[model samples]
Target: MNARLSGDEKRGGACGTDNAGLTTSTGPRPRRRPPVPEESHLLKNAAIALAAAGTLLLASCGSSTAPSGGGRSVVDAAPCARSTAPEAQGMPSTERIFGWIEDLVGIGYRRTGTLEGEKAAAYVKCQFESLGLQDVHYETAKSWNWSATRSRLKVNGEAVDSFPVAHTYVTLDQPSVFSTGPDGLTAEIVDVGAGVPLQSVQGKIVMFDLKFLMPPALLALQIEFLWDPGLTTLEPTLVIGNPFVTSYATAVERAMEGGAVGFIGVLSDYFDSNKYYNEFYRRTQVTIPGVWVTKKEGARIRQMMGGGNRSANLVMEGFRKEATGRAVVGFLPGKSKDTIMVQSHHDSVFYGAVEDGSGTAAVLAQAQYYASQPAESRQKTMMFATFDTHFSGYQVHREFVRKYVIDKETPYNIVANVTLEHIGKQGIKGADDQLEITDKPELRAIIENMGPTLKLGMINSVIRHDLRRTALISGHVLCPIGALPTDAGFICAAGVPTASLIAGPNYLYDAADTLDKVAKDDLVPVTKVFIDLIDAIDATPTALIGLPLKSPLYESGAQD
Candidate 1:
C-alpha cells in the first residue's frame, strides 16, 4: 500500500526509472546507472583496482579442513575473491544471499505460530545444518496462535468490508476463542478523528483514523549532524524515512477505558487498501475488539454517521489457542567463551520478503561464511539465530535474552551482537502522490550502541562497501529504553554492544512486500559490512566494546 503525505511539504520529484534502471525523478534530475546485468556490485572490481595492494583473507572462502567443533565442512566454492580491505574479504553474491530469501518467500504467510511460520523455521534449521553450523536445533518459547475465521461490519444497514485488527480479542466465555457472540455486536457509532481526548464513546463503537509518523528529510539532516558516515553524496529520501505509528496501541487503550465496546481504525495514511497487516503484533495487551478498513471505506462510514446517531454491527469470529514459537539456533565455538551473535527474525505477517526474509538471508550468509572458516581462526564463538515470535510479541527474543544474557547458568557469554533487517528499495512519490517502490535501495541505518573502536569499524565498513545513504545512528537516539528498533535490541539494552542494520520501508507490513522488494544489489555489500563489524568487535577487548563516552566520528560542532 502507498502512503499519502500528511501536512508536509513535498520535495524531490515523482519516482521514475532512468535509462540506467536506477531511481530517477521525473521532474528534477540527479543521476542514473545501468541495469544489474550491465552493471556489477559496487565493490566488484575492488580486488582488481587494488591489485597493487596486498590481498586479504576472505571469510567466504572454502576450506577442506572441518571446523574444530563437531561441524561439517562447507563444500560450495566461494563466489568472491580476496579484497583490498583486510577485515572485508570474501563477499557473497546477490544470487547466493538472495537464494536464501527466495527459499523463505516460497513458504508463504509466515506469521507467528502458523504452519507456514513453522515451515520457515524448519527451512532455516536445514540451512544452518547444511552450512555446517554446529548445534543446529530449535529453541521453543510459549506463544499463542490466533486467526479470524469471519469478520463483517455493517453501518446503518449497509455492509462495509473489514478485517479484524491483528491480536485484538473479544469477550468470549471460552478461553480458546474470541468472538462477538452468535448475534454479533450492534451499537451506535462514535467518530473520534484521532482517538485523543476520548469523549461520548461509552457503550458505542469508536471509529478513528490511524495516524502514522513519516520521517521527513529535515529530520534526516538533523540525524546526520549527530553522526554521519561521511558520504560524499547523499540522497535525503533514502536516509531512513520509514513511516511509524506512535499511538495505535495507546488509542486502543484509551477507547477501552472510555467504555467503547469495540473500535474501528481507518488506515488514513496508507494507500487505498484494507488488507494491511499494520499494528498486527506488538507486546501490548488488546482486550477490546477492533478492526481495520481502508480510507475509502472509512469515508463512507463517516458520511453515513455525519448527522444522526448511526448504528454499526460488527462480527468477528476467531480462535486463540496455545502454541509454541521456536527459534532456530546454531553455533561455531571459538577458543574463548566470549560469543558474538548474528541474528534476525524468521516470522512475518505477509510474504515478508523484505520485512525479514532479507534479514534472515543475511544471517544464513554470515553463518555460511563463518562456518567455512576454521574454528581456531575465530576470536570469539559465533551463534547464528533466526528468532520466531516477532509477530507474536517477541516471546522467543525475550526468552533467548533471559536464558543467555541474564541467566547465570547459561553456557555462552554473548559480548556483542550484529543484527540484520530490511535491505530493500526506497519508496517515492509517484502519480497521484501515491507511495511507489523505486529502484534505489531503501535508506539504511546501523543503529549501533558501541564504543569508538567498534563504531569506527562500522563507519569504515559502510563507507568502504559504498552502502549509500547509510547512517551509524545510536540506537537510543531512535528508540528509548525497551523500544530499540531492532529485534536484537534486548542485547544492546543488556549492555552487549550491538550494530543493527535496519530500514523502514512504508510497505514493510503490507502485502506488497514481495520477493522483488528485497534489495538485491546491496545483499553482498550488507553482508560484508557486518562481517567487518564482527571482526572489529572480535579484535577489541570485550571490556572496551561499549566503553567510549563520545563517538570518534562526531565532529565538535557538527550538531546545530
Candidate 2:
C-alpha cells in the first residue's frame, strides 16, 4: 500500500491495503472530501480534488463531452480505443443490473463463511448456468469461521451498550469476554488516545475513544473549497482512503501488545449517524477480546473510572468451527488457450449492493453480452469468477490462481485479469462519514440523489497517474492494471496484467450499505465500460497490455 504513482502521494487503495471492503480490497475504501488525504481533516471532496490538476477524466461525461482542465481539451489523449469503443458500447438495461443486485440483497447479507455467503454463491452458479456457459461449477476453499453468537456486557451489575467484534476471542472456542461488575471484570478503566500507549493502559481495561478526524492538509483544503465551488485554482490531489481504513482490531491488537487485559472502542459522531450498527471485520480474525460502544456510552464509562462501583462484564460465546468457502466459476471458450479472467468478490459485510453486488452484476451482464455475440467473436477465453472469503482475505482468489494459473508449468495462460468492484453511485463520504453528492464534477450520480463513491475513486486512482491525460472521454480506455490489492490481485501478483473496477460507497463495510445506497441507472455505464475493458484487452495483443511491477507489492503471495 506504500506504492507511489509517479509524483502523487502513497495511495494504498491500488495496493493491498486492508479495510478491503469498498468503500474494494480489504473492504471497499471510503470516499473523502476530495484530493486531500483523510487524515487532513479537511473534507471528502479534497481527496478527489487532487485529481483536478485540470486533467480529470470522467466516465459519465462520455466522449462527446470533453472534460476541460486548464483551458485544454483531453478527449484526444484518453486511453480508450477511439476507433472502436467496444467496452463503452452496447449499454445494458439498468433493470437487469438492478435485478441482480436486488436478488443478492434479497438473500440478506453475503458475508463469507455464513449461510448467506453460500446462498449468494448458489445464485451466482445459477446465473452462469442460465447464461448457457461452458463448464460452470463451484470452487471450494477453506477459512476459519469467527462468528459472534453471543456477547453480553454490563457496567457495575447494570447492563450497558456493547457488541462483540468479529474475532474478539482468545481461542477458537474458549474466547474470553468483557464484563465489569462486582464479580465481573473490575479493573481500573483507562481513557486514552486512539491507540493507548503501552505504559498508559498496561494491565487495565483500556477504553479508546474513536474520532473520524481528517488530516490537517485536508482540513485546510476543505476550507478553501467552501470559498470556491467551481474550484479551478488548485490542482486536484488524490483522495486518501475514503474513510482511511481504520481497524478497531488493529487498534485493539496494539492495546493487547501494550499489556491491556480488555479493550473497548467507542464510536465517534460519524458512526452514531452513518454507521451506528456496523459489524466490522467479521470476515477476519481478531487477536484479543474486544467490543464497541457509542460515544455517549464511552463518556459514561470514562466518568465511572474513579467511581467505587465502576465495573463491567462481557460474555461472548458461539465460536464456530472451521468453514468451507466457495467460489463460482464460468468460462466462455475461444479459439486458443489464452484466458482473460474477469472476477468479483461475492462476500460482503452487508447487502453490499454497490460495494460488490454491482460488480457481480457487471460480470453477469458481460457474460450475457458475450454470450449474445457470435462464438468466433472472442479469440481468447473469457472467465467470470465470483469469489467468497474476500472478507476473510481473498482466499478464493488465491486458490483459483494456484489451481488454474499456476498448477502446471505452462499454466492456464491467463493473460489479463479484470475485477468488478463497487459501482454506480453518485456520492462521496465527507467529514463524520457524511455523503456529499451535489458538489463534485467527477462524481457521476447515476441513480439520482445517492453518490457514486466507488466509481469516483476508480476514476481518480487509475487516471490521476497519467501526467499526459486530462479528461476521461469516449474511447478513453484505461489500463486497469496497477499495484493495488484488488479481486484480481492474486493473478496480478503472478504477473498477469490486472485491472480492478470499483468505487467507494460511504457505508461499504457496514450494514448501512443497503439496496437504496446503489444508484440503479449508473450501472449502465459502469457495466458498459466493463464490457469494453474485456473487448479492449481481448482485441489487443498480449504483449501490449502494460503490467508494471514497480514495487514488491506486485508480488502476490499473501491471501489478499
Report lDDT per candidate.
0.66, 0.53
* Tens-digit per-residue lDDT, 72-95, candidate 2: 232221222111212212344676
> Would you estimate the TM-scores of all the predictions?
0.77, 0.67
Which digits, one per residue and each the tens of the lDDT, describe model 1 over residues 1-560?
13442110010001100011011111111121111222234533542333212112212222111121234221222222222222222345676577666656655567776656765776676566656677777788887677788888999889998878877773332236777887789998878786553575788888888877556453454253222345432554543335454458777778887888888999776666676675334435677777889888999998988869589999888977767888889999998888999999988777678979899989987986787788889888999999878776677776787678766356789888889999998766455536687777776677777787777777777778888868777654433244466787666655567778878777788767777778898988888888888888878788888732222112231110
The positional error of residue 463 in candidate 2, measured at the CA in angstroms, is 12
RMSD for all candidates, in order, please.
14.0, 16.7
Q: What is the Cα-based lDDT of residue 22 in candidate 1?
A: 18
Candidate 2 lDDT at 260 equals 75
TM-score of 1: 0.77
Candidate 1 Cα outliers beyond 4 Å, as residue runs: 1-91, 170-175, 214-244, 279-283, 307-309, 432-435, 476-480, 548-560
